[model samples]
Target: MSVESVVAAPVAKKVPVEREHHGDVFIDEYEWLREKQDPEVLAHLAAENAYTEAQTAHLQGLREKIFDEIKSRTQETDLSVPLRIGDYWYYSRSFEGKQYGASCRCPIDAEAVGIDAWTPPQLEVGAEIPGEEVLLDVNALAEGHEFISIGTVAPSRDGQLLAYSFDVLGDERYTLRFKDLRTGELLADEIVGTTGGATWSHDGTHVFYQTVNEAWRPDTVWRHRLGTERAEDVKVFHEPDERYWVGISTTRSEKYLIIGLHSKITSEQWLLDSATPEGEFQVILPRREGVEYSVEHAVIGGEDRFLILHNDVVDGVKAENFVLCEAPVADPSRMTQLIGHSDDVRLEDIDAFRDYLVLSYRREALPRVAVWPLTESGYGERRELDFDLELFSAGAGSSPEWEQPTLRIGLTSFLTPMRIYDYVPATGALLLRKEAPVLGGYDPDEYVQQRDWAIAGDGTRIPISLVWKKDAVAEGPKPLLLYGYGSYESPIDPYFSVARLSLLERGMVYAVAHVRGGGEMGRLWYEQGKLLSKKNTFTDFIDCARHLIDTGVTAADRMVADGGSAGGLLMGAVANMAPELFRGILTSVPFVDPLTSILDEDLPLTVIEWDEWGNPVADKEVYEYIKSYSPYENVAAKDYPAILAITGLNDTRVLYVEPAKWVAKLRDTKTGDSQLLLKTEMSAGHGGVSGRYEKWKEIAFEFAWLLDTVGLSGE
Candidate 1:
């Protein structure tokens, strides 16, 4: 169980592959790892896993202790708040030993009406309801498979038929299946190779689904009759542009079927009446470069209209953060401004219902929700749902029913477990339905959550969210773990985690760096940290680390940095830029070889990413710009912090080879004797291990390494 037993790290065979782009040629010694099916590649990955296991064998007890702490804090047997759709109230339940949740529903009380009817039923855990029926038990489906993921669960308008999709492999593609809820039998109709979601026709005779192209982009929508064969399904819509991916969904009103086509920045929506299953779809707005819009069906002032949330130029002024407009159903081009754009607030989404419209937005770097009433007269004044917490996130939750008088809003913070509320618009009452159970008798007052700022090189103030146990920092400069994800306008909001308590109890501080490239501070924040300005993300993170050190929160030697996916790319970049700022770096499925990947058109999601990273293949400046900072290309023969890179063999988004090549290059080049390890999950995908227990183990593995690197492994 000693590190000495692991004789040496796995040496990846050097098979030089030349990649030339924009008159620039680069030799990649580990490019041969990209051959996923090759026996040699698999053997190398196995060897890497073996080496990682041996190097960390002594931490087995620590990992198990963390995992057990997570398990004990979580309520194993629980049921979700049942949502009323039609004649039934649907919910899911998880048993103590089950790896997956069971989808179930019970008949709604016909006697209840109005607000009473809209309220979600409070179901007890491990209790059976009268006339309850199990729709899909994922645990049963996952019995023989090492990994199983349920993608979409859609029931017919009448609640008699269920159409769902699941993936046995960790890959994104799924198989569509239908279940007869009344008979408790599965239909003979089965469709494979779909993107995992389906929209049903009003009459339940047909369902529309999407399939991916060669590059794993969902580009084609197909319509399948309930009793028809897969080959008989008609291709209803297809997007030929590789930059745009397509998806199909029905609005909450169930009045219109929408086919949404989107790239990084631009979007176009096609609409079809739900009543007509075989009708052609009409584009509400043609595809316009740099313009994005989403449509929702709304009945306003006794007239059918389409509420369009868009970022288009109005009166020669660009609505960069988006504005809401209403147009007649017959002519969507004639727009009437409803909600104008604001420089301070970014309007993210508007969900239209029969009684009201829910607005989800971001302001002051916190998520906010507002309700606007819709009556026969006109729209009422918007009411913002305010909370007392300054460092918390609040937004709309699951509200599937169109006529429901109550809106489901979820609120949480670093110290608060998720609390679900039913907001009654008419009375302005927030009814507390349920809060996620933390079974360890945890106290929110025992933890401290605060917001701090770091000054970037360009004078931008990047926000950092810090959370630690009240007693952990009394002695000053405790071990700190800094987490970051700054990409694709995706904001990592404040939320509660049960597993995080393990770190807090052990006297550790957890902080999140709200750097640019995220939508935390609004659209402009994202704009400043993407493409040519991506270096800002790395620099901003380093500045945040320095800020923590300067403020006496933690020293460089006591800090560890962690990020995953696009955030994983941040970890790699920062490790190369400022290795001295931390004792360890943990990256999951890191995009280290960006320049090489983006230059190859054959790679999955390369074309769609051009808007985010710039078209490196077609532009010499972009090629050189990416090569300058790409972790793999810039890795030097210098000392580095301890590094642990985790990846999945079936990850289609960030290929496993990216991290494999990254680790191989680091091991071969880096000067330090710091322990470098790569652990690839053989049966998982982008999200890692599928089962809850397995996922807990994965987190334990990472957290344990973090603790050990920060000199608190025994704790």
Candidate 2:
């Protein structure tokens, strides 16, 4: 018997709740959905799941087929290029039918040193390499847990102690544990509620990690000794201000332990000498309101220096574009410009090493990597790695050593699979390490990738990247999946997706709307799309969709919009503002209740988010502005497009209640009968399902629905 035969669609009971802010009142009818512990809430969620399953029952075959296509195109068993750190070459391998990968490392002998060390040792997909020590087998850790996430696994300086953190549920809170490599046994030490990473001291006796507050914000840094109980861990540093979160990391040079406290607009760093495990942390440049910067320890001309990538003015000149400067480590305020600010380049980050410095930046709306050679006289020539592809992403890979000459970089494009290469800066040669294996005879030349622009509402140009099979369409409108996430300064860079081929092969064009809120253009681009200028993000996406229609790329009736998290907020806003523009909308863990969420300082990460979305609770003006655009608050009684809202039961980032309440209101208020579905992942969190196989199924479910909505579900 079919599972859907006995289950029926849910009808949520509406209980009006009046929420007041700034002399204004909001009557939220579906507020009862927020009662997560209520029996009715669970029943409603289950009913919704059952209804979604019933409605899409016919797509089951298609979903499995799509999942199979994804599996077939991807190598079931694969091993990553081994990265050398200290005396070991570390790599991870996935086995066929396993949900997780196994982390392994092999010892480095004399033959595997020097230039050859830069190149990764190639191993067959399912073959066992000699002298490989199993560091952490995630598949074993995930044996019984329905949802298991290996947060961060970092080995100590001597590579004898392994500090790893894992989350059994979807909640971001992870439990950190230690393992002894020599004894091959789990240590007695364990720390709970960590944010998932540990920074080990140079001597490996103490490890620094961040712990979450009641609001789930990592607001405190604690240092733990190797053999002590977790309660004995010292609170090394605490960020009292709720607006800022704290993190700890060791510099690439292994010279200092940096405890960074930052919010959206402001940042402050405290540096502690790595050699002195028990020492005071000194502030490096006090926090400034608008100025933001990052520092890396470097040695140039036989003098100790700090490489600062900042938006601070030098002397009397203002640096609109972030400039690269060098300063004495003792006094970082006394700075001299090394790389002057340029309108063309947006300096992103600097990875400093003993031999050279690798800069990851963006130019012409594309990511670029450059190497600055170190010399006795001063810093030598700065060389930017060249790429032949029109639109691709290239950035530094896992080059962890301080004195390594060759840089490891990763490159990918819309049509190209991920490629790892070793760039020898001295010789100006890029040695190909490995290109991602696409098992079923995939060809990059069979597809097309393009970078197009659309004129936004305020005359600003927004970039849109498009990819589709070559013979899919030559003229007229066709099925197009327009994806966007224009918030949090997160750029949706072009990369290969094995699952996306299902859409492309089925005559669906995939497009990414690089709207203003993203970091694609520059700092100003993000500045314009946030806070008071936030509406530009929604209008920019609308303009991109209209541009697609105007250019005969796709018709409005054949288009579907997709975004998640902050982008899911974009999806809600655009759906409310322009319901007729899209045939359907796909939102994952949508943050639709922004006004309610940001106003409540108790929610996870809400206070820290005030910098991104202004503090609505204290300021009436900010309250009004956010309330005006908050998707859930702004939902009106109008015809709307078909919408599928997906959420995780344990999502701490954007609660499942946001989407649960959103769909209930939409079903009750929207005039159209276009399908409105909600699917809550019972055992997942912000990232949905944890395992690769389950995740692939979830992707197939969403993709199949998209194909069905766009009339491309037919064989």
Candidate 3:
């Protein structure tokens, strides 16, 4: 990542002139673009403008209908009660013998329910703190109406002092609270109206935290001396600029603190020595110019050297590898690559136990954990920890094996919820701490997970994951939904899809296209699939459809592609490349105007994201490359498939206006009237339709769309 010598100190860059035509890779002139008026295009634009105006009412109606439907579908199931820890289970919050406080996601049976303890080798009913579940009739952890999960259970190193955070609305203004676990008494919460950002000092005698100050955007850090008599005793550590984000990484050593400052993407790492939280923060690494990689995070141990996780791409194509820099407290020597590059071995998690480097990664889309003795050169004699590592196109919410370098692991997959185990590297002994119990009547046999390789027209072998019921027809042109995302070196690994399972059981085939740009197959896969060469992603998706159809899995008419955000970008690009190859298209929050976005730097996250998209502004070659396929501009009035475009009003990353305008041109240009409907979340941000029930309803709506579009439905 090369930093341009000029920093945007004074309004940084010019406010990019809002382009008249999106997808215009290159234009003769901005003035000419704004001035040129083809009546035919303007006429099409007029009809679209009118339709968009009419949709103001239709969109309102749809919002009300969706909200009503969601509300009606929700509140149908009697929420589960929080259970106590016992032979079957106990609330972690209630388990006394457990080192940490017992907490569980069990349904609350009654209001103000209590937590109960449970041990596999069942503990005897002794004078230990009696485990019980005091169920709450209402959502105890409700986001707004009730208590929210403020910050993580901030307990002391000794599990004595506990600090936590909670908030109401999505505005993220949180309230910090501290409690003495032994006495169950409240302690001073130095920062009252705070968002989720707080950490404890190694000694547990002092607290370091940050809160959004005067500005609504940037934040400030503070340190609170524990056992203080006055609230005014807390000291302010540092105030970050509007463009920079400030955060603290607490280490076991009380002498050092890792201060992270970033303007979102380009980051600066600093180490500070604080007498109290109010101490000065000196610059450790004064903006490593042109070096842009997210600070993987650090383990503060002997000498307090930090192991940084950086996706150092040589030409900003595919992410290079994770590098470990031995920055002892104040020493930030250029850096060293602890682990070398691997298209397969993604540097997932680098954890430091008492003395080992627990390297958790995904190999060939399979979950793997490697243990190494921590050395200056990085891990040694890496031992692999094994479990089921399936690759679905979707992501896995469950974590992987290994609590840390201590040779302990906690593995969980989409299909397999959670499992805790202890491993001895020296003797190869594996001990199971806890195996996740099957809940919600989940059965793997109800469906299947399979991977197939499809070769594109250009000899590119693409991986496609097919998940459906075991008895699902092998030859039938089933109503199928294909998905893919190929950007930012993100790998869409194998993970269970509960919503997809619900659909697959109804005879619909769910497929994930492992195209280029994504770390699906590994480095080569990602490298071949990015930037100007990104056309491979579109062609590969088309190949996936053709291959599946040719193999008798499904015909063209039965294939429906779905992608959101970057995937949405994939969906739109694929639609343009092969419009008739699929039955329907769901492009949610898409970046349809990739060229325009890169050309215009005013867009939020655009300037910083140039590293990911390639600087078309500085580099003419990249500019021409992006302009060639910019989805919005290239959309000609052609016979196209049914397109459903969804966005959000408050999405700063991909503004609702992009979708609004894209759909406008799409509706006007499409040779056929493929139902082009736009749905916007009036309030939500990137993660749309949050909340368990709300999320489920949104899934149901999508399922309805695909079913309706492809003539397949469970109901």
Candidate 4:
């Protein structure tokens, strides 16, 4: 199937809109594509979708084959490990033919105590369990909607009511609703345009949730009573700053409600006693630029305290990576350091429990979990949990009950399926609760996972994770698919994927470039790759690709690059900077017109992103710097690789117009006759689609394209 032999591509009409920022004037020809309500814009998007379908029609069989492979290897009829919350053991079940999971729970044994009481009930996948009650069947809720996303399924403290939210339009504005769990009937209270999560008050009379402002920043927290109208909900807190977002969550102990106000580089938390739903919230700490912190309620030495993970100064020295401190609940200003800051370790989160505190951090570019004992005297020794795999990810999972004796830890790697463990803090026992089933005679020994390093232009070493079938790569320089997401300090950790097996069995090598602008190597790595130094992310990725080729892992012609969202921005930058390094590029929801998007304060999430990408409107230097590297602005008349850009029509973040304009400009400017396609999900959002099966098909479509681009279609 020659892509070049397909019908002529859809040419988007050029309607120039001049944008001037910091005395710099630029003409955007495809700016008209941003209007979602315009019939012409919708028609163009439909035409582009038709063009993409016609071009990739030959790959439909292969897409189905890959999808079947994924389904065949996955345990379709499955149930997650039950988590104990209040009087019920809550879990979700997935059926073979179902698109969504069914939330279920069983009553806990009141007669049982200690280990027997805390241990989750082991329920079979298809077996009928005694006292099993279905909470929410998402499949039924998604009956009429083209797209449906379940946001929050929070149960009340007494387990009598459930507060859940759902989004049907894919714009991320959810409609919050209440359900009487005892009667299995929905209540009168309903709130619209929420940010998708609700925190229950201790007495179960009210729930606190957040709502987004015009800029799509969750800036207001509201408290809604169970039996009231939506308009009657009280505004608990509102963040006036556009750069900050607000979120509400109750402590694990259910003793306090925390309202966290955060920007990219700073944070301030407000705390209120959960016992009093109408009580005023007190500021735990004032927001300071460049200082970020998170608080967890803990009872130590028979006194209530706030466990704070912060990057604030200690003894006049800045704790950039962060340090753990404890302060009196009444006066949070008096802080006492519990764990000093470490330059090598990045403290990500801290969860407090009755017996211990779980510390989630990153060390040596890998996630690490540690348990600190809480005794009657004070804090005891801290023990770090160790895993055997060289390239794997391990973190604290859903252990919601504060008094539960065990910590749920989720572990996985490129070769290992997800394994959930209950870590006994008292005896230091790691009890394996469940391991995800992989059907069709799967074996981890058949695959190999390796960690390699590439030196950047500045002499900094970047880590690259490589995984492939041991036998498939014996011939050397096999077709490779390189994945990257280096933005927002988000790391692409090693994990097992059933869909990726389709690529590996087809003799393709998969590698992840843990470049800068990610949290893989700590805060310093992210700091180096963002704002003014953002180009380092693109160069680092290119260097990683070169290292792979130089080491005979894969040749340039056999390689295809993939990234989404901010990483899609990375893709656009790299395609313009080093188009010769890859045979093809696959970007989903690409932020190609970044400079223009950043310059517009009215766009969703643009104002809050100033800390990550500099404010081009205010800073002329930043304006020029971003324009110099922005992919849409840098599209040149040069031979480029086959490019496939995917986006969703209703996406609020990294709107669909960026990629539309990008592909349209690429078609006009690029010199090569290479395949350039844009596939837009007309009914979906930033996530592309809803439902597991639909998501799997989406992955299959992407995998098929990547395989075909790398000459592995016949495999």
Candidate 5:
């Protein structure tokens, strides 16, 4: 038999399951695919994988070429700029052929000025630093495992003990482990199913971490002593509400341990003095519905004050744009507005220092940082750090020490490589520490980046970031891949990617659509595209693609689109709404069966997602509204753009069954002969596959397939 005949796609056996919601009846033929562990389901997924490999067999060389191009552009052996925290200057280094890096630290020079004074060692890429202590060799730990991810690498305050968390299966449920850094020996204590973030107490005798529930939500915080068994760990706090997930962290100054409970629309924080490790935590502020706030401990005017960034009513004014407020630690409810709320500026975060307060906010849809110097009496004038790049991203980096005089700032754009800067507040100078080493002599001037706006159906302007090589001239409409993820209020900001160079070098354009569901334009932008307004997210994406076609950037026949997770929902909706706009679609871990998934509140993360997506089980209107656009329910007898849905077996965020059922339905329902492929990573979870080399190869495969779909593989 021929190889093609041996790898033909499997036809899924359908046992139609009739589901009723809001008095509406629906017949789902592929519902049986949700039985993930069933032998038949596994066989079907395996068949799909074999079929994907067979269909793309011709593009194996192209995939390798793309992977090599990515490798050639990246600096395989590199060292990150050291960040000073406490008495050590810490950094991670990647070896030439290693899949992971080594986290190491070196003692500060004894001749430094102040008690908190430290200077980063200036070392060559391959040169070794003096007194370098390897804290964790991830490459060594990753050996013999198909998937390994190091979640948290936190060294204790005294730098004697290291609390690290790692996941071996890509399931995100990490195992918390400890090591005696001085002796280079592993501790016997091991805690499983942790969220991975370990917060150390001031004396370093205890570490606090959160444990994940059955639904994979971190809901309980536990404190484990250095020499105690995991079973003896004390439950410091437990959040009974399923919607609110919990996390624990210590203040930068190591003064207090914070237990944060977060839901979709509400948040509550509890504080425990690091000095009193066993003491009960006190609530910083009680939780209020529809109000969100974060607390930062700051010492001002000889008194410790809580600097809060919140969206609560202030002076009878609705805090639409978040306001920075100061509240006495004793009386947290009594807030004094420090920086009054403005319609244009949205306060995002506040990082407190011993002598200054760094405010990160958004103005004009771009991130801006302002430094407020602390005086004996009060705060002085706020000075904003200016950047020359018009379309770039800049924010605070690893400023670990609370008393440091310099702020580590990270800057990059679509065309620029990642650059690290040390901003000296006193001199107001942005000293360039290091720019990511791009192998083969890369120049930022060889690329062009621009910003354009697409008018949405409702007259809302959606931002689009475009980047391409300067020499890749477009005489006519070219192959363009537009990407978007417009959920969770997360901003899809412009970033530099060495692998993206392969596409741009091959005369392909890459654009990111900042649709309304994201926080790109502030909180209002996200509000208008979620819940009942969710359809706007799909429409906004469609509008952006139409605008690109109208502007002659790419024709409908040459364009491809992509989104992952919630954004995958957008991809599915667009495929149903405007399939003719693109030649291909890439949906990664897609949340396609929203109506069915949301209706089953017992499913993982379903209850928590009620705020982002309305509670379809309780509200009939929500059920009907969601059913109208749910990708799996909406698939009909029409031509769909060639689809490539990628998923993993152990994904808790969005089950692999979503894409599995989605592909089965698409294959059975769609009229056109366009490709419908599903590639399931049997050993991996939501992240698809682990290991740096494997990740690069996966991207190469996807890019090769995309290039082939648009007839650009030969180019």
Candidate 6:
């Protein structure tokens, strides 16, 4: 009997090497892609894009192919809403033969309000709860804004009050509002036009939140009384630190509020416990420098404490975090490494509940989940449960129904939409709740997930992820979009996307170059591509493209390279290196002037970012390296391929001024007949466009430009 299962059984097998990449055919395919084209097709492609009539006719064809491809390749999985919560899967799409029309508790469902086919769900996949209406329309709840969508939702400790937020159309401004889940009465509403987070005090007397200013930097802490409608929002805390951000969490007893100050990549937590919004604030732990700390909600032996997920600079920033013993702010001298990095894996998806730490992470290509009991002083031995598989996921709190045992997780992959489970933290055992399988006609077996490592000039192995329709590679160069982000320690992980369907179904090749500066391969991977070593990001991206061409994945001219922000900077630098090698180049909110960006500390995130990108101001070493590959400075008076650079009118980070300056320079200095076009979102900020349809339209328009410029139409 399954009385209590301790730790997950080892059922996940290692992913096998691909048959195609390992066989003799691999060499032939690589040579075939490297083989020079006949030049006849290339000439025709060029001519068609140049002639006005050909350009018009070709765009229509491109549109048809993109839609057809999206439908054909990703026909099995529901791309609408895909997330897992405790013992229950939360999605906007239909489930268990029941359909949602235009309102649901899901975030995406709320965003799709008013639009056709938009429906709301009660967050239930199947079956009915007694007295609980089998349905809840999220659309009806959106009262003030036409483009309102749920940003974040939080429940009081007693679960009596619920707080949520939404933003209007074309405006980055948000409205923080709360509603009584039981009474369904409007509680309180405040206009917050920034990236502020709303959470409640333990007793539910005070509502705490942090806000951002026009500069896009988080600046204030606002508090409101729970029962009052006319509660004045008095600012309780403010840190004028440039490029600094704060995250808040409260102790289980609600006696203390934890505030973490993050400057650049380093951070430390401070505590504040004020009865009124204007009460005195306290510092729990003194400030510590050069340490990276993160706070998450955790349950310890049926008691809740603010868990600190952190790592210290032992020998440089190549560090791994662990469960440090203490509150949100801990004794820096006593911070201990609870978990260590693996030789072939990285740890993530950490949460606390039921006296145990529930975690899900990747080992090689497989995913696994387990729990470690939260001991009085530290952490207990890790216990693995019955689920460790290739396509399974587990997490804490993806649902509101989970209560007993309280250990929950998410599981799914290429074929499965999502499977959520609630389990006993001490014992890995599934709890009864909901199962959300896709209702549409879609299958996961029609395509493949390929992982190939491309070796750079210095013999660094950069991982490249490829998702393509089976046997879709053509006898000639296939239309490919190569994407990468080489800064900010952001790992470009393997995740599914519905938007990618348009490309995959069209016999197009999609690739993600997990280049330098990403945490994909862990801390070392990030270290190799930052500051003085930043060139690694651009060079690594170039290597990924070269690898694709060299491996018969796709030819040079048949591809378009893309990135945004720092990745946009990546796109510009690489394009400059080989303008004749690409057919189109796409960038959004690009930081092309890397040297200038570092030099100007006044820019958003620039001053604080010197620790990551280096202050080229005083150090001659930093200055030379930055100028060596700064995209804007390197833009020679050479003709480039068709380029599409996107920006926002009010962007603060990366600044509209950045892309503004870069575009004007490109228009003046570019020698290529390659159309240099810039599109600015008049009302939006750093995020270019809003709304689902708007995003699709923006992407479609930009892609249309690529197809027209790269001569990939009318085939």
Candidate 1 structure, TM-score to reference: 0.99
* Residue 713 local lDDT, model 3: 47
Q: Per model, state how many residue pairs clash.
A: 0, 0, 48, 0, 0, 31
Write out the backbone clash pairs for model 2.
Answer: none
RMSD of each: 1.2, 1.4, 10.6, 1.6, 1.4, 14.6
Alpha-carbon lDDT, every model = 0.92, 0.89, 0.58, 0.91, 0.89, 0.59
**Cα-based TM-score, every candidate:** 0.99, 0.98, 0.71, 0.98, 0.98, 0.75
Candidate 5: residue pairs that collide: none
For candidate 1, list the clashing residue pairs, or say none.
none
Tens digit per residue, CA lDDT, model 3, 1-715 = 1123222111111123434333442332222112114454334333433443343332343334444544442223221222222122223332222111333223223333211121122223232433333321124445245213335545555555667665544345666667775576777554566647667765677777776655433356667777675365454455444456677874433445667777634667665653354556666656654444434334433345556666555445535544444444446555655666665576655655444655666666555677666555444577776554554221222222122222435554445444556566555677565544443566766666778889989886788887787775455677788888887667766554445555665678888887888875655566677766788878888888889889888887888998888888888888888888888898777887777666666555565556566787778778777777777767887888887776654555665556655665676567875767666654555556444555655666666666667776423
Q: Could you give candidate 5's per-residue lDDT for residues 427-528 as a string of tens digits?
A: 687888898878877888988999999999778888999998878756889899999999988888878999988899888999999998788888888888
Ordering by lDDT: 1, 4, 2, 5, 6, 3
TM-score of 3: 0.71
Superposed model 1: Cα runs more than 4 Å off: 1-4
| Residue-by-residue lDDT tens digits, candidate 6, 1-715 | 1213212211111222221211211111111111114363223222222332232333765665554444343323232333332212233432221211222232233233221112223333344422332123444443453344445566565655666666554344456777775687776465466453676776677777777755556667777776655347667778787657766666433555777678756776666663443466665445567656665555554444555555554445445532343452334344435565454555655655435666666554344667777777657888766553343334454423222345545655443455555555544556544444333444568777677889998999888877777765567667888888878767665556665655665577778888988777665577789988888898888888888888777887788898999898888888788776677888888988776566656555676778778877777677777777777667779878777777765556765545544554565567856656555565566776654445655666666666555455543
Q: Measured by TM-score, how close is model 2 to the native structure?
A: 0.98
Candidate 3's C-alpha runs over 4 A off are 1-195, 203-246, 252-256, 261-268, 273-319, 323-344, 373-381, 388-442, 522-527, 595-602, 616-624
lDDT of 1 at 293: 96
Q: Write the per-residue lDDT of candidate 4 for residues 446-538, one digit (tens) a residue.
A: 999999999999999999999999887658777998999888899899999988898888889899999999999999899999999999999
Off by over 4 Å in 2: 1-3, 6-8, 314-320
Reference-based TM-score, model 5: 0.98
- So what's the TM-score on candidate 6? 0.75
Q: Pick the candidate with the highest lDDT.
A: 1
